[model samples]
Target chain A: MAETRQWRLASRPTGEPTRENFDLVTVDRPEPGPGEVLVKTLYQSVDPYMRGRMRDEESYAEPWDVGDPMQAGIVGEVVQSEADDFDEGDVVTGNLLWAEHAVADADELRPVNPELGPVSTALGVLGMPGITGYFGMLDVADPSPGETVVVSAAAGAVGSVAGQIARLSGARVVGTAGSEEKIDWLTDELGFDAAINYKETDDLEAAVAEACPDGVDAYFDNVGGPITDAVWPLLNVDARVAVCGQISLYNETEVPTGPRKLSKLIESRARVEGFLVGDYQSRWGEALESLSEFIQQDDLHYRENVVDGFENAPDAFLGLFEGENIGKQLVKVAERGE
Target chain B: MAETRQWRLASRPTGEPTRENFDLVTVDRPEPGPGEVLVKTLYQSVDPYMRGRMRDEESYAEPWDVGDPMQAGIVGEVVQSEADDFDEGDVVTGNLLWAEHAVADADELRPVNPELGPVSTALGVLGMPGITGYFGMLDVADPSPGETVVVSAAAGAVGSVAGQIARLSGARVVGTAGSEEKIDWLTDELGFDAAINYKETDDLEAAVAEACPDGVDAYFDNVGGPITDAVWPLLNVDARVAVCGQISLYNETEVPTGPRKLSKLIESRARVEGFLVGDYQSRWGEALESLSEFIQQDDLHYRENVVDGFENAPDAFLGLFEGENIGKQLVKVAERGE
Candidate 1:
């Protein structure tokens, strides 16, 4: 039997997840069944939303049970195939096990186009995070020309793209990030009109007010805590808020309390909508096409912070909460098979 | 010159407004200017939204400065007119001063149809509250047939109509109110599938869950405090929440802190929107026509807690915070002209 290394959930974290919550073990590599393809992992995605699946709570993502193999979006090369659509050596991407080798249904996997960009982008800018930001900004928030748009956690994979999309629409874009490097990346590289280093600022509201002098017409919320509380009161009348992620509250054992904001929504007549990228599955092709064109034209830029080795996957996931990654955080599990 | 009694803001309330915040004074009845009409107040609206105007903070409704005459939706008889649209003894409704008489541009006033039930319906079922519920339910939190719709403050003017409208759309309607009478009015009178007396219930979430077994698909939020917190977790996938009023939080001296809910919205992919009736001005005729048809067909029932005298208008307005009125709260100032 062929042996494969895999990561499994050792236990659920009470608050913030640690390296101890994950386990690495070698197991017998199962052969592909009918219509299944055995894939050798190249890169796997680590996202803020994955924090939600670690807990027992019912959320949009299914919770991972203790002692179970962890799963994530992975771009890999097909080593063996029982499916007619996939052949050995084909590079494909799908939600798969965090392992050196795993079998997935061929139907679930998408063929990665290396021609569009780097194959690693299949798990970053050209993948789930990119589509999430694309639909969330252009469709949900729908910022207009000359309007002010603010994006929280703006140097992260999703927020970075969301802000740039708003800027492309001719909106004045403002972004908030934790570090000075992230702030500079948002303003200098991403074409954001302004960026606020929230960790350095004593008053985020005043900082945001200085950045968004016209008031926020559209807000892409990724971290929902004091940053969101500050932005809530500054929303212009008829503001549109795209509630894509609440990475700030994901690790809290207890539901955190904050200033009641529905009253402010009424004052601004704001529309706050929570959405998942999977909901726009039918229209994802539209996003991928636009994102690829923007990338090829040098209009859209993306960053990847890749951690080498399958054993380090937990560290990369844990680092997300510590603000360690600048953009899409990924784990390079193995080299692509020939 | 004839004198008319008017109520002015004595001082901005720090917390809950009191009778002392109002100063009743006799002032000379204002004369009509060109394109203006002098309207004698007959039925003055005392609504929960008026509490927002009393604050010094900026809101959708213009804040009343200290000693400024308090203004609200008023159904009155035109005593004099300098415009071609209105004449003496013509019953009209407009956002007018809370007094025996005040001057308003003829363009701002809408002619009241006495044949459409009582003329006071112009301030209750056939007016702003009716129109608010109409659009908020039909347009914002649009419940599909067989979907579960939950309405908080379900016996109040906007809520009562909102609940009934959801019921009319073939949705399984649930409501929450303060009193058993209000509960009875919701379930028994307004055709709600279930009604929870929030004042009597120890666990509002459990009560809401029991009432909406399939989970809440739509929520018409009139009071946003504990009731909203309870309903937030029960939202089904793609639920819509129409935030019309936060009467529960309106009286708080400071912004109240509660369990953060944006995360729950992400779990359900729900959309929460805050809207004002004034924004739908161009299409109000559509609401009025539909509301009138529903009222005349006995498909919609309305209640009025008319405080008999204008001297008690402050009391009527104050009572809204206490959940005193079952339906519309109005102050009947005078009889229609002979």
Candidate 2:
């Protein structure tokens, strides 16, 4: 029997998750069943949304039970297959176990096109996060030319792409991030009109006001806390808000409280919609096609912070709350054809 | 010159408005200018939205400055006209001053059809409040058949009509109001599936949850505070919230704070939109036509709480915050030919 290392949920976190909540163990790599492919893991994604799954409550995504094998977006190479669609050494990606090796139904896996860019992008810019930002910005927010758009957590994988998409639509884009490096990446590299280092600013509302002088016509919200509280009052008439993620409030054990905002909506006649990328599943091809063209033409840029070893997956996920990664955070579990 | 009694703002209120905030004075009735008509006030509207205008800050409607004549929806008989569109004794409705008489541009006034129930219906069921509910329910919320729709302040003018519209569309309707009479009016009179007396309920969330076993698919929000906070978590997937009024929070001296709701929106993929009746001006004829048909066919019912004197107009407006009126709150200023 082939041996594999798997990460499992040792326990659920009360507030912020730590390494103690995860357990790593070696187990036999199970044989592929009919229409299943045995994949050797290359890279696995760590995202803010996974924090919700750690809780024992029902959310958009199903909750992760204690002692169950953890699952996430995994980019891997097919080592063996009982499925006709894949063969040895073929790179693919799917939502799979966070392990050195795992078997997935062939129908669930998508063949990675190395021609598009690096295979690692199958878990980053060319994958779920990229599509999430694409549909969230273009469909939900729908910023028009010359309008002002603001994106919170703007240097992260989704925010960076969403902000650039707004800029491409001819809107004046402003972004907010925690660190100066992330701020620089947004304004200097991502073509954002302005970027606010929220950690360094005493008053985020005033900083946002200075950046968005015309008021925010569209807002792509990733972090919902004081940053959103600040943006709520500055919404222009008929403003559109895409509630993409609330990374700021995800870890709080208690229901968080903030300033009442629905009153501001009436004053501005604004529309605030919460959406999941899976809602646009039928049109994901449209997002990928556009994203690919933009990347080909050098209009869209992406970055990754790849942490090595399958044993370090929990730490990479924990780092997301600390704002430790500049872009898509990933764990490089193994080399292809290992 | 003939005299008319007018109400003016005495000063902006720090919290809840009081009788001292209004000054009633007798002034000479003004003559009609070009394209203007001098209207003799019959019924003046005292609504929850008027509270927003009393504040010093700008809102969807321009704020009324101290010493300026308070303005509201007025149904009156045109005593004098300098325009070809209106004739003397023709009842008309417009956003006009709260007084015995006021002059308005003929273009701004709509002719009131006395045959469509009572002329005061121009200020209640057949007018702004009616159209507001029509568009907010059918358009913004867009409740479909078999969906669960929840309405707050459900016995109020806009909410009564909105809930009925949802019921007419074949959705299961639930309402929340302050009094048992209002609850009875909602479930018994307005055809709501369930009604919760929020004032009587100790656990509003549990009450809402119990009423909506399948969860809420649409919400018509008239009063935003604890009622809204309770309903937020009970939203089903893809719920729609039409934010028409936040009467509960209108008089707060400072910005009110409550449990954060955007996270719940993400869980349900719900859409929260704020809308004003004025935005649907072009389609008002469509709304009024449909509403008139519904009324004529005995499918729609309306009620009015007439406070029988103009001297008590401020009291009528103040009573809205206390949830005093059963239906549309109106001040009967004078007889049609007084």
Candidate 3:
């Protein structure tokens, strides 16, 4: 038996998360049962959406109980295996724990192809966030050629992929970020037509309008709040808005109040639909295949903000709320087994 | 030439409309030229949607320019025709002015088949409101059999038809209306599974939840504001909302704010789509043919809140904001040609 150091929910967060919300503990790692593989975490994803799961309520993801280890998107090496599909030293990815070692059923793990790109990319642009952007943009917000597509949280894992995909679809892509670095990355690197640093803009609506001169035709909304309020009025006739996430309101202890917009929707004949990437479980292959092609062709770009050491997982997770990460925020637990 | 008594926009209204916003003008009736017909106005629809047009901004319906006669769905009779399609004394329906008489291009008019039902139905169940209800219910908020469907403004022209159509689809129909009279009409006359007088109810959310034990599968929203805010949480997984009208907010002077809801939509994977009846112009024949069949079979019921005389057209239009009308609000301008 080996030792596993893991992060657990010490308390449910109030308002915004603090370091006191989590506890890092070491435990005796157990042996794998039949049809299971012992995965040693190399990289684990930290996302803003995990904030919602901390609450004691039913949501898209199940709530986390106090004192229980939190689960997240993890890319790991198979240190030991009792399953036929995975060999020792094979790199795999699945929804796993923020621990150094996790016992997962072989069926739940997907083999990460190092031949495609870095194995860590599986936890970022080639995983749930990427799939979310793909399905939400293509299925829900179906932007047309020459139309303006606006994405919020544009430097984050999902929005970066969404904006690039919209640009690839022959639409002009506009994005809102929090820093000048993110703005530069979105416009200079990712080929975004316009990138607005919301923290720097005084009148967000005016900034969005100036960026989208013809008004927004499609909107990929990830951080809903005042940002969404600003985008509502600028929607052109027959616009499409895909509600992918509402990270801004995830930690609010009380209900948020803002402008009512059904009247705006009616006049524009627009559509606002909420979607989850899990809904396309049958089409994961299709999404990954296309996403892999984009990466190979150098059309899609990705960045990973890594925090070394497994014990620092909670800090990495908490950093998401402060907009500390430029792209996918991940905590590295160990080196990959060769 | 006959002197035509008509109402024109005196000024763009600020806040709620008043008498000062309109002017009653008497002008010499103009003659129809090539490809036109002279129609003697019989009935003119006065709806809540007209309030949006009274503003000076572009909307689904173009803004009514100050000092110009406003147009609506009018059931009229052709007195004289210069076009080959129309004959004298033929009852027709088209978008026409609020006047004693107006000339219209023949291609813009659809001859009302009075042999099927009363001529007044051309302004209610056989007109734009009916088609709006039809496509909105069937195409957007597609409720399955045994599913629960809730409609706001249930006693209004569009909502009334929407409920009946949902009932015809074999779904459980619930409605929210203003008065006890309207509630009874929805439950007893229109065959809604449950009806709530939103004005009378203290806890609307509880009432709606009790009525829909399985949660709402589809929502046909006509009145937006607190009424819609109540139905947001009761939505089931994959719920669909057809944003047909927002009569409740049409009179709002400033930006209206309430609890934000994009988070709830994301959790439920629900869809809210705003649609205009004009978008389905190509499918009008299909809608009318099915709607006419419903009328002939007595499966659908409709009511007209008729304000006698063309002189009271402004009063009828304003009454909609006061929630005075039960169903289609129309001013009877004249008798059909003998």
Candidate 4:
């Protein structure tokens, strides 16, 4: 029997989930049953959306049950396989949990090869965030050549890829980040035409107007709040808005409110739509393929801040709200195929 | 020279416009020059959007200059014509003003035949309001047969036509109104499957949920604010929202702020689009033809609250915010010219 530690949801958090909200307990691991594979967790992705799952409220994904291990996107290596689909030492990435090991059905995980770059890449660029960025802007924003596409949270995992992809499609890309460092990275490294550090800016509306002189043709919104309000008036006629996430308001004790900008949508003849990645489950293959190509060609660049322990997962998760991570935030639980 | 009473923008209002905001004065009407016609205003449509134009602030249309005649959609008769396109005694509809008479370019006015029902129908059903209802729903909501469609301000001009159009397309229509009388009119006269007086309901979310058990497939939003917040969660997957107007928040001294719900958009795969009739400029012929057919066949019904006398126009316009009008609010300054 092997020892494993599982992080369970202790209680729903009022605001940000503290260490008290999660309980770490060690338990003996059982042998894999028929049609299942036991995977040793390697890398776990921490995202802004995971904060939403901490609440017992209804959302796109089911709420995490109290006393159960918190689920997350993880890359791991199979240690033992009772199913013929996966063998020992096979690398896999899927929605598992923040744990040392997970026993999942053979059909639950997809095999990943680190030869593509790094095992953690499967959790970021070639993973959920990558697919989210690829499909959303292409399928929803659908920017025409020479059109201006603006994205908020630009230096983050999804926004970074979205801006680059839009640029590749011949659209001018403008992005907004929280800090000057992130803005520089977005403009110089991620291929964004321009970037604005929203934190330092006094007038968001003026900043956006200056960055996008022609007005925003398409907007990929990730951090919705006053920033979104600023972007509202700048949207051109027939503009498309892909509402990815509202990380800015996710951890509030109450609903974070802003000016009702629904009227702006009508004034601009614009469209604002919210979409979950799960909605594109059938079309994920197409997204993955295009993203993989873009990555292979170096057209899209992804950065991951690796915190070296499973115990540090909570910090990494909390850092997402503070805008600490440069791109994708991930936690390496243990060595793979050990 | 003929005498004309013109209504001009006296001042911008902080919230709702008052009688003092409009200045009506009689002046000598200029003769129709080449390619222009002298129109005798019979009916001037009072819309919620005209309030937005009174301010010098930037909007879809340029703001009305101080002391300039406040423009609105009007149905008038050509008492004199100087262009080859129009002739004397021609009944026309144009984006005109609240005046007894005015000179306009022939190209700016469209001939309205009384054969298409009463000429006033040109101002309500066969004009901008009708086209707004038709295109806003068809292009944005795209409701499927047997799907549940909900609309706000359902007894008003746009909402009434939108609900009826959705019903004719095989959608079960649910509507929300501000008063009990409006609710009755919506359910009985407009053929809505269900109607709720939002003013009477303490819990809008629960009320909307009960009325739309399968969830709303399409939402024609005329009044956005707290009512929209209530309807947001009840939207089914891939629900379409056509944001026509946000009348509830329009008169606010400051922007009505609330929790940013950009994240909720992803949960429902919902789309909220703002649109103007100008976007459908090229498609007006198609919409007008279809709406005309619906009216001719008696498949669509519209009611108008016509206020008599040009001097009472300011009062009638101001009555919109008080919910005094039954349907389309119009000021009848003179009889329709045959």
C-alpha local distance difference test of each model: 0.91, 0.92, 0.91, 0.87
Give candidate 1 misplaced runs (Cα > 4 Å): none
Q: lDDT tens string, model 1, A62-96?
A: 99998999889999999999999999999999999
| Per-residue lDDT of model 1, residues B1-338, tens digit only | 89999999999988899999999999988999999999999999988888888887777887998998988899999999999999899999999988989999999999997876799998888899999999999999998999999999999999999999999999999999999899888878889999999999999899999998999999999999999999999999999999999999988987799999898877788899999998999999999999999988899998999999999999999999899999999999999874
Chain A only: TM-score of every candidate?
Answer: 0.99, 0.99, 0.98, 0.97
Docking class of 1: high
Higher-scoring candidate on lDDT, 3 or 4: 3
Fnat scores for every prediction: 0.82, 0.81, 0.88, 0.97
**Would you estimate the TM-scores of all the predictions?**
0.98, 0.99, 0.98, 0.96
Task: Give model 2's docking category.
Answer: high
Q: For candidate 3, report its TM-score.
A: 0.98
List pairs with backbone clashes in candidate 1: none
Model 2 interface RMSD over true interface Cα atoms? 0.7
Positional deviation of residue A95's Cα in model 1 after best superposition, in angstroms? 0.9
* DockQ by candidate, in order: 0.84, 0.86, 0.84, 0.81
User: Which runs in model 2 stand beyond 4 Å of their true positions?
Assistant: none
Model 1, chain A: how large is the TM-score?
0.99
> Best candidate per TM-score, number?
2
After the best TM-score superposition of candidate 2, give how far the Cα of residue A121 lies from its true spot, in angstroms: 0.1
CA lDDT, candidate 3, residue A284: 93
Q: Is candidate 3 or candidate 4 better by TM-score?
A: 3
lDDT of 3 by residue, A1-338 (tens): 56888889999999898889998899998688899999998899898889988999998899999999999989999988999999998999999987888999999999998877888888889998888888899999998899999999999999999999999999999999999999999999999999999999899999999999999999999999989999999999999999999888888899998999888888888989999899999999999999999988999998889999877888898888888888888888888763
Order of quality (TM-score): 2, 1, 3, 4
Q: How well does candidate 2 score on lDDT at residue A244?
A: 95
TM-score of the B chain in model 1?
0.98
Ranking 2 against 4 by DockQ, winner = 2
